[model samples]
Target: MHKDRIWNKWLFKVIGLELVKCCAEFAASVDFKRDYLKILLSDYLPESDPLKKWFNEGLKIGLEKVAFILNNDNQLVKISDIIIDEVGLLTRNIIPNQYIKEFVCTNYSLPGITEQNVLQIFPGSEKLKHYGAKTLSQSDLKKISSVRPFSF
Candidate 1:
């Protein structure tokens, strides 16, 4: 049982690191497809894993950001609707609580991230309560006021 716990922790860590790398690369590229992340995640995790739920939530948030960046408010709304529908509003709210808490507790070191700058990179706890798990942050929300295509 102890060994299993250790293995699971290691697995989550590996998956988390890979997901972050993939998300960054996908976000920066012009050719990113919305389903590409789903496919990649499915390859790494089983369908019923709770971690998959959290990762998918992150993917949805990223997609919303992309839609906002492309000036497609309609698509953003659709994405948000899909999230609320798939997870239900309540579960959607709870999902982010565990997700963000685990993320911070794991102490996954990102480049240039430190105690001093962590809040700047990721919103502080108080700010997180405002954004919750459903959205990214205020700046992200502001950017999404308009939406556009994925074209560079």
Candidate 2:
């Protein structure tokens, strides 16, 4: 049991690090910037606009579910909220860099928010919190990962 606990801790740390790295790479990509612009435009623009239609129709990505077992309670919890929180933090850190800012501005013309007002814009966690993180039993975790092969 003690060995299992130590292994789980190590595993979660490695997974978390890999997740952060993947997010960083995705955040730096042109596709991410385009998707960001689409979201912004879709939210703020008139419903009838063609760009809004394009955003609604063209950019839906399926959610990837990740679950973690809590050490204290031994309850499984979906960690999407934690990932969302971390992504917000990463975005905040990345956007301030002059090179990234220049690249975004040079490539895209955002509505309302521009290069001059860019510093003021940040992704809000409240918007990302569509659902509260859910706690699950070990059995529930098994059922979820059963469809896909479960791995350590």
Candidate 3:
């Protein structure tokens, strides 16, 4: 696991890479429509990646268009939404929950949603295999919430 390379471990940052990998394996099973991909590009891609941005954006647009079809907001309160929302939290690599939680606290209340539920919301690391290598652990969880997500 590239534990050192990972900044926090939020999965959204790496979703694009993972989706690309899946395009090769289960081309039909996934939900990326060419149109949706284009929309994703114009909306989600950062302006700074330069060449990579160009390549990835073009590819996604084509991939979406090639499918000849495509399809596809947030007052995230609660750690679950926070975890899922801040997934961009790991843009380059893993993101620490500490960084993410602050955002969550701002929008959502902690009274209802708990950490265990939040962890459940976290997509498995399996989907994130492409971005650096890393395994999740209890200590890593600490990087997220000083205490457990469900420490009620």
Candidate 4:
């Protein structure tokens, strides 16, 4: 019926707009947590704090994941890739979000990619199909601090 088509179109537009808003919100949250962790580790925390190491490593992993996502030219990333379900990487010193804490704590090793694997995970392949870099550059990182999440 004509009414049905009109209603469906309206619903679809509303849902699409909501999905975009949700994606933006999710990206902002990721950036916020990364920034918060950096400030806590570098400024507020003392050198002697036993939890510093764990926090530092966790932050490193998080940043690496961000690099991986951006380097791949992805609009959205999977939570499973970012958050592992391991048991030792996390520390109680400064617990991050519930999911992130569990992801780090349970994973046996830090997420890593070898030189060969880097070509596949990020840009800069031998074929020159993508950008010429193995990881997110300083400029890319600086852009993350800006209002726009994606500058590349």
Tens-digit lDDT track for model 2 on 24-52? Answer: 34444656632332222222224364444
Which candidate leads the pack in lDDT?
A: 3
Model 1: which ten-residue window has the lowest total lDDT?
69-78
lDDT of 4 by residue, 8-123 (tens): 54554444334333433444576542222122122212325334333344433443334332212333342223322122213221223333323323432325422122212211
lDDT of 1: 0.34
Give me the candidate number with maximum TM-score. 1
If ranked by lDDT, best first, what sequence of candidates would result?
Answer: 3, 1, 2, 4
Clashing pairs in 2: none
The C-alpha local distance difference test score for the whole of candidate 4 amounts to 0.31
Candidate lDDT values, in order: 0.34, 0.33, 0.35, 0.31
Better of 2 and 4 by lDDT: 2
How many clashing pairs does model 4 include? Answer: 7
Residue-wise lDDT of candidate 1 within 77-141, one digit each (tens)?
11222111122212334333334333333333222222222222121223222222223343432
Q: Per-candidate TM vs. native?
A: 0.25, 0.25, 0.21, 0.21
TM-score, candidate number 4: 0.21
Alpha-carbon deviation at 68 in model 4, angstroms: 8.4
Q: Provide the RMSD of all predictions against the true structure, rounded to 1 decimal.
A: 16.4, 24.1, 15.1, 21.0
What C-alpha lDDT, on a 0 to 100 scale, does residue 59 get in candidate 3?
A: 45
